[model samples]
Target: MSSATKYTRGHATFNVISKAILAGFATACLLPFILMIIGSFTDNTTVLVNGYSLFPEKWSLAAYELIFKYPKQVIDAYKVTIFVTTVGTAIALTITTISGYALSRPTFRSRNRIALYLYFPSLFGGGLIPWYIMMTQVLKLSDSIWALIIPSLVSTYNIFLVRNFIRTSVPLELFESAKIDGAGELRTFGQIILPLITPVTATVGLFIALGYWNDWFLSNLFITTSSKYSLQYYLYNMLNSSKALQELKAISGDISIEIDLPSETAKLAMAVVATGPIIMLYPFVQRYFVRGLVIGSVKG
Candidate 1:
């Protein structure tokens, strides 16, 4: 009968309702991935006949078997992708954070001009032909792993994200305090600024890693040797080859040659394979990612 007891009950009910809604929303988001994973295991014919389902009538490993038919190639592609993602993310985070910090500092007189130079490319590009010529003819990066790492080393958008995050989330007094302690730019950055911007750093690092991981365009353009192909590019080639085989079979109607290439299921399988590592990586940065985005986009 007490007023405080009624308020407590109301708050508890609100919490329960909120949690239930969030749980349902989370399940809705997760169902598609579950279906895709299950659908990949479903028989190709069954999928065509019944469509995707969480519980498929017939489950098969044909798609996975085909993907891993040559395990060595997949493994090599994984190695290349891992190397590129690791090295590229490190270098990218370094450059982006440094550039962002410099631009965020009010003492830097040329920051506005430098930022204009950085932002100009985001709005306009010099066309792909020139970029390709520069990469292949001038830089001589063709068929080299550096080709993959160098081109995507610094993202303008990422630099801006870091700059904004630092400008908004970090205080100018911290920089001054570090300077007062006789710390140089590098020392202040490493000792003070870096730790304070952990959320944005994780967020930017995740973005860079995902970009490097999912990149297939650079591989398709610069890489001639199959050995240097990234995982996504390798899987893309495999999927294309599967489609080609399907098309060939369709074209060669009366030949009576049996070809059992999983097309739809192969695509599902490739998605699963390519996204596995990224999915695993997401949970680690999920805590920082949302916070970083909010603070970084606060219009500081």
Candidate 2:
């Protein structure tokens, strides 16, 4: 690395090279998603010809039409997903924020021990069979929406993020002032602490929301009812069924049907539909997320 003064040749060269490199890297990252969007509109034959291009020679909505054919089912799945993400995120944030704050406080007697205990799960976990038994048999959460909400209500990693944010960014003097002024723990947390940690709270809240929104494994493991399927799980089932039927048809040598199913494009279209809103959510929280990451990265 060269240490150069302002506007020198080396500095100017590095700046130009850095800008081009970043631009290319960003484009590389976005290329697949761009291709996916284009591919969703490209029919099977056109895809065969163009093979995932910046611009497709032909375009069609047959895939989207196929997907929306069961609009009621899709809508119901959307409602279930929306409800889960909203309710689960709210509850998760409350639990994670409160626990993180408590753990972050120097005055808390067992803060270090509790933080370690909370972090243990992220390193190691009980086996899947035992976890399943606990949820289904012990807790009686099988086939219930609570199964989705409760199991992932708080994450060890997220708690640590919150803890670090509070310990580093929030001043202890403020808490002492609140204590001297006769503010209870709950009141201090709600009114003063909550307002101060808005950046970190938003960051953690976004993480929880994304986790809830994209969850499908919990549905696969616990949920059996079609009516209760989240959007991701519903799409997973659709894609799996389509692939299974295609495989069965190939094995059976059945070529009798005249109508072609939008197999590949439909899968891509479903991906687009499921994740579209989440992509839109990133911009709203990006500033807070950057601040939280920076603050949380600092050691206490």
What are the models' TM-scores? 0.81, 0.87
Candidate 1, residue 162: Cα displacement in angstroms equals 2.3
- Model 2 CA deviation exceeding 4 Å by range: 1-5, 12-20, 48-53, 256-262
Model 2 residue 119 CA deviation (Å) reads 2.3
At residue 84, candidate 2 shows an lDDT of: 94
- Per-residue alpha-carbon lDDT of candidate 2 for residues 100-203, written as tens digits (9 for 90 to 100): 88898888999999988888877888978998999999999999999989988978878888888888878889999999999998898899999988878888
Q: Would you list the clashing residue pairs of candidate 2?
A: none
Best by lDDT: 1
Candidate 1 stretches with Cα past 4 Å from truth are 1-31, 44-54, 254-267
RMSD of 1: 4.3
Error of 1 at 107 (Å): 2.0
